[model samples]
Target: MTGRHAQHGLTLLELLVAFAIMAMSVGMIYRIMGGNARNAGELETRQRAVVLAQSLLALRDTVPEGGLQLSGESGGYRWSIHSALYDTGVAGPSVTPLHELAIVIAWDDGGRRRSLELTTLRPQRKPSPQVRK
Candidate 1:
């Protein structure tokens, strides 16, 4: 081979190494993009779960305080509401009324069930007075 031609072109070994490096770089880029897309989807699911939990919890005021369990679905999520009278471990005062409310939101993620829960205590509503004729 001519000296000029040999010097002007990359050696076979060097070209192979260059191609290997480029392949590795492309693989890394593809993996990073795939991971980013998966993370975005997971984040979206988590955020929507939080919203569903919040909405279910907000219904505490309207829920029957005698202990109720309700189930429903919305926004690609399923939710359940559970309520029970909160006990302080002591005898009730008979006047103070309180309820413990729990809201659970669940969804299907990659064939797995993902869920979030929100819980709080709320005061019991007063009964309406009787009307006279």
Candidate 2:
């Protein structure tokens, strides 16, 4: 019996094509996962910023008069709070003082700047006038 063994196997070109397809699929999956991770991180940062803003607003009295610019880092994020007098209103002179509070929370995301701002109006007690002779 003359040897006539038939070889059944994928050609080199076929194998190359299969590898290319697999590489493309892997690349796509990697990109999708990366995007998901980024979105999750951004969401987390936003939540943290909200909580920080609330706490800051609650403690707004700590800020000195004429407003202030405070900045710091916490939980892998950078934050800033800016307080200024938005308006004294047109109510003329009044015993009770009103202030505009603005809190700005900021952070970095993949070289992009992200921030959240919270603002409100707060009433403050007028300082007691010094007694004169």
Provide the TM-score for each candidate, comma-separated.
0.75, 0.56
Q: What is every candidate's alpha-carbon RMSD to the true fold?
A: 3.9, 6.1
> Over 4 Å off in model 1, which ranges?
1-9, 89-95, 130-133
Give the Å error, residue 42, model 2: 1.6
Which prediction has the highest TM-score against the true structure? Answer: 1
lDDT of all the models against the reference? 0.83, 0.76
- TM-score of model 1 relative to the true fold? 0.75
lDDT of 2 by residue, 45-124 (tens): 79998998888777766435566677777776666776655455555565445667777788877788988888887766
Per-residue lDDT, model 1, residue 32, is 100
